[model samples]
Target: MKPLDDQQQACRDWFEGLRTRICDEFEAIEREAGSGASFEFIPWERTDEDGTPGGGGVRGQMAGKIFEKVGVNVSTVGGRFSEEFAASIPGAEDDPSFFATGISLVAHMANPHVPAVHMNTRFLCTTKRWFGGGADLNPPIPYADDTADFHAAMRAACDAHDPEHYPRFSKWADDYFYIPHRKVHRGVGGIFYDHLDSEGEAWDANFAFTRDVGRAFLDIFPAIVRRRMAMPFTDADKARQLEWRGRYAEFNLVYDRGTLFGLKTGGNIDAILMSLPPVATWA
Candidate 1:
């Protein structure tokens, strides 16, 4: 196994910590909500560009009677970001030199009332370095309180790092997560910021902000789920869930940079695609 690079090591450490924290919090939330939620951590391994260097990480799944399914996957894809990665986005074609420390995560909730969430943070280093990641919500049945609570939790998390961050990133998310064809948002927007630089102390601040949001996830998600998990669902709600999932499929396959990056970098296929929900319906 080739030695992990500095950035790769950092990503591995941070995600390991995050995995433990999230699982513990999930367990606590399940107990309190009286939901029989339990999770399974699946250990996985993969090779680098040449299949010479190897690395491994954990993927987790949580499901219950009340909740359909929730998946959390963490992996490090180390090597030059593949040509496929660059090709996925039209403008990225000219970029030649590429090296990246990739970390991606997403949570899918079973209840239409609660909403599904996705987040990915990565450090891509060429001659320059930057951070990118954001969290967004996808509620099946939109309710004012649920949307407000979800956004408020995210806003508080961002504001803790910098007050200006909330509006700036929230707008970015709204724009980034939109579906032009559908003429609707993937969900009520949260925070999305990308390409944060290391110059003038912004690097430190950006990571600090990212860490704060990550830590805040444990608190934010369960609160929303607790309130909505027991709510009654009708066939209509189920139909909407399937309809919205089609939009999600479009975004992940056509637009998600992380998904593209993972595929390009020779990452594990199952791990890279784990962001997809267990079940989805079109139209």
Candidate 2:
């Protein structure tokens, strides 16, 4: 898609910048957190139905001997939103017009104590483009302090741009991250919202908000890692971690609209599935 508007360009640039910052920050954090860690960025190309070139993304994987796995991925996909694609996702049945562009990202941490997190910040245009995406946590084992810390960091980020954002989106995260059958949350929630328009002053404010959250990830997650990474995990803890991972895979495969949308749109399979843990046991 042509970069026709300022907001679209800004969103693109922001994602580029975030990709760099996250990779660098994670490397440093991994070193401080423990040993036997390594990260590699995977490059991907986006193509049209006829194999015509479109766009691409960067996928990064960080694995440690101490921890199971960690991955962070960023992608920019633009083109027509097909009906077939819309039908794949749970709520995206409307099948908007032919023009869509945005960045989607997800981060999964290896340590069961650290929690897995996902975020997709994008500026998508149908009739007109709009911004969406937020960060949320999914912990295998609940730690109230860590949960509180994660939320507080997210709240602070939102508050920097708009004070009203924290409470509104916090509740949104809580509602979105819930698993009905289990009667439990995927994790202590952070924030989730979509369909933000770049009209009035809202666009500028939201851009700032998005940037704040993007930067906040580096600050919030590593601290949790430092606290939990070296802590001894028993066989039972490992078993539970794998069980929780199964739940994670279920949510992404069954419930997450983003995963469905990506897969249906012919997104990079490896990058899309980066949210899955490196090692998981169903039973």
Candidate 3:
């Protein structure tokens, strides 16, 4: 594995910082809910095919009064992609060597009334570099208000970058987050975009947009959580949430690109699977 350059290091640092901020905010919520729970950070290492040090990351997780299971992970890793997989990734067509740094979080609320959510943003470099990711809402008991607010936050983030972004990416999310076999949308869409390749002087521009996406999430999601976390839920609601979680598990295991990327790159198994809910039921 090659050493990360200045730009790569900057991305790594920013992702780690975001991870800390997210975990802190989540822990605060747990405290506010009168739970003493806090994030437990688990460190993991990664290595290249030759068994040389590649990179590693910490997975921060907590189960408490508010959040049933939440995972915020940040990793920076570099190595060559498998030949078969290399063909699918942009720029890796010619050379499979790559570097990636990112933060990924998924929260499954204890209260069925509270919506679960997923957010991730990553910077990857092969022969080229680009940024990708977005956030989406997953409410088993759908709430129009929460869906609108989540999309609104995402829209504001996109507008700051480019007016065209929201529409383009919202459609992308709708398209990407669907489960064809189940014939159901994963959740009310927010935004999902990729291959925002740095086209000469676009790195800073893209990075700024990515940062705003993270900030938008930080600003919006917790408020939504707090709003619904304390709402009363019955056994039926809990059952619905578990069934929805089953769909979530299917999507992650079968189709999530992040999961595939982590697995292919020799990522930490526990961290990669940390997105799975603590319990899920199929109906």
Q: Which candidate is the best by lDDT?
A: 3
Kindly list the per-residue Cα lDDT of model 3 for residues 1-283, writing each as its tens digit: 5888887888888888888888899998888989999999899889898888888888888889899999999998888888999999999998999999999999999999999999999999999999999999999999999999999999999999999999999999999999999999999999999999975789989999999999999999999998998899899999999999999999999999999999999999989998899999987
Report the error of model 3 at residue 199, Å. Answer: 4.1
Query: Which whole-number lDDT from 0 to 100 does residue 196 have in model 2?
Result: 69
**Per-candidate TM-score against the hidden true structure:** 0.85, 0.87, 0.98
Give candidates' CA RMSD values in order.
Answer: 3.1, 3.0, 0.8
lDDT of 2: 0.72
Off by over 4 Å in 2: 1-5, 33-36, 84-110
Over the stretch 142-218, how does candidate 1's per-residue lDDT look in tens digits?
77887787788788888887788899999999999887877878888778888777544776677677777776666
| Minimal lDDT window, size 10, model 3 | 1-10
Per-model C-alpha lDDT, please? 0.71, 0.72, 0.93
User: Model 3, stretches more than 4 Å misplaced?
Assistant: none
**1-283, model 2: which lDDT tens digit per residue?**
4444666666777887877776676677667755546678888887866565656677777776434566667666666556666554333466444334454555555656667677677666555555777888778888999889988899899888778888888898888777777777787789887776667687787778778888887788777767887777778877788898887777777777677767766788988787776666676
Minimal lDDT window, size 10, model 2: 95-104
